[model samples]
Target: MIRPKWTPVAWLADRMAVLVLGLIAGFLVGLSFAGDGRILPAATTVASTDGPAPSPVPPAPPVAAQGVDGPIPPQVTARMRRGGVLRVGVFGDSFGNGIWDALYRQLPTSDGYEVLKFAKEATGFTRYRTLDLEKRAYEQLARDPVDAVVISFGANDAQAVYDDGHLYPLMGDGWKRVIGQRVDRFVAAARSTGAVVYWVGLPVIRDPQLDADMQAMDGFYEAHMRRLGVPFVDSRPLTLGADGKYTAYLPDSKTGRPVLMRTGDGLHMIGIGYQRLTSGVAADLRRYAARVRQAAGRPAPTPTGEPR
Candidate 1:
């Protein structure tokens, strides 16, 4: 049909207008989803919330073993293997002091147990010199629970006089009695902590008479330790050579010759002496553990000479 030209143009314009509107609508819908080309679909977008995040699980607390009066029983081996720290408090004079630094260097860094040392120089058991030493030692024990304690105070106490009208050498008989009582108090202090206590008796000296005094002190210490069921490590024999004399600074066991075991004063041992003393003590500690196990009616753990 031959239609009017203006009518055809108007119809074409109307169709173009509808097409433009449809394109505009499509662009708006696309903008809503894509968000200015920086966003993904609205369905995939997430919004912030006001609630707390999920909490993380915490680790369980350490298990504390029950009180052990004497030795570690056999049944507790599994528990000990689970591994806890071993804090140590050393009470003694120069001799003990040497061992402390040596052990501090020798103890394995990767070992399961941890060792702590508290010491005072030239300190003794008796109140003759200072009660400060005793007070400090007690404070250390109270601060932490230790598995073992080592005592090396007799060297200073061999000539110790009590404040109770007793003196050393000059007061002879009464002096010994008072000194013994003071030692007892010292041992009692450590005993109350439930730690396996090891008393390192004084070593042999160059003077024969000093050796005699040390012997008497050793006897008294051993008796008290046995009475209290504590371990006594008599290092005098280890320090002496086969010649029955205080071995040279670092006496060679096989040759009976002096090695480098002392400082310039020829009285105190150097690092090597400390090494020997600690190794011996470490061995004895293992033995003590075994004895404790047996006493506790459990299978004794094997004794090791090396540090754990």
Candidate 2:
């Protein structure tokens, strides 16, 4: 890669690119939808001290006030498993990828669930020009045909944004408006397909500024989801310690020894960490599956076409 001179204007331009690319990868590896899958939201706020004693093995998703705002829409619940099996498509950035991994296992195929990954692509509302999530959503759902959607993004979104050829600070009104519109459109596209959509809020971060930005991102998404009647999943409590603070290492469920839950980059998590972080998402998916079975009055989920 050719290095650009760090002149004032060049440095500013480079930072702009960083925001669009999530500040991690050298190139954009957008999430694939309308063809393949993945989804996302953003987060931050980390505590330096060793967090308090670990909470229960898997904390229940937050009640409406904290973790969630409303229940899954009834219309979606009614038709989610129309063909017997419920097909769920997950989307977002790296965290979305982890959540998909956990959900795929939590809601196994034998139980009449097919969890397709939508996170393979590195895309989000911030990457509006790199990929069109809303359009891909329609195309992807039409091809893969899922009855439910799960999305977690914004981890790499605490940066700048673009609108009408103008650059906007991460938290600027223009950025929020653009990102919110993007969130609404992408989610609406998913809902239009009659799928129950859930937006997983940003998880705890180890950085102060980033975490604050992510908190704002969470509120933005939660408000949008609530407005559209899509269920919103809060991720903070799932990762926060008993004292309601961020901790990168939590005691292992079995050994009770502190285990690293976050990556060196302060963005990603290991399998064990993902297990802790995604517990709520896994729960929500299972609950929906059970509802489908009960509503169908079936002994077992016939879940469409033998669990893809």
TM-score winner among the candidates? Answer: 2
Clashes of 2: 28
Which candidate leads the pack in lDDT?
2
Model 2 C-alpha lDDT per residue in residues 1-308, reported as the tens digit of each score: 66445564765674465444443421211121100011222122211133222122332233232112234455545555465667889888877777676676667777777889877435677777888778877888878767678888887677666656566667666676677767767876776655667777777777765688888888777766666666677767666766777787776756877777665555566566666655656666666667666666645744433211
- Candidate 2 Cα misplacement greater than 4 A, ranges: 1-83, 241-245, 253-257, 301-308
Each model's lDDT: 0.52, 0.63
**What's model 2's overall lDDT?**
0.63
Model 2: lDDT of residue 93:
80
Residue range 1-308, candidate 1, lDDT tens digits: 67456463675474344334434432332222110001000021111133222233332232232223333634334334444323456766666666666565455434333456665555565445555565566777778645567777665554535443323341244454555556656665664566666666666666565467667877776766665555566666666665667765555535756675644332455665665666655544454444544444455333233443
How many clashes in each structure? 4, 28
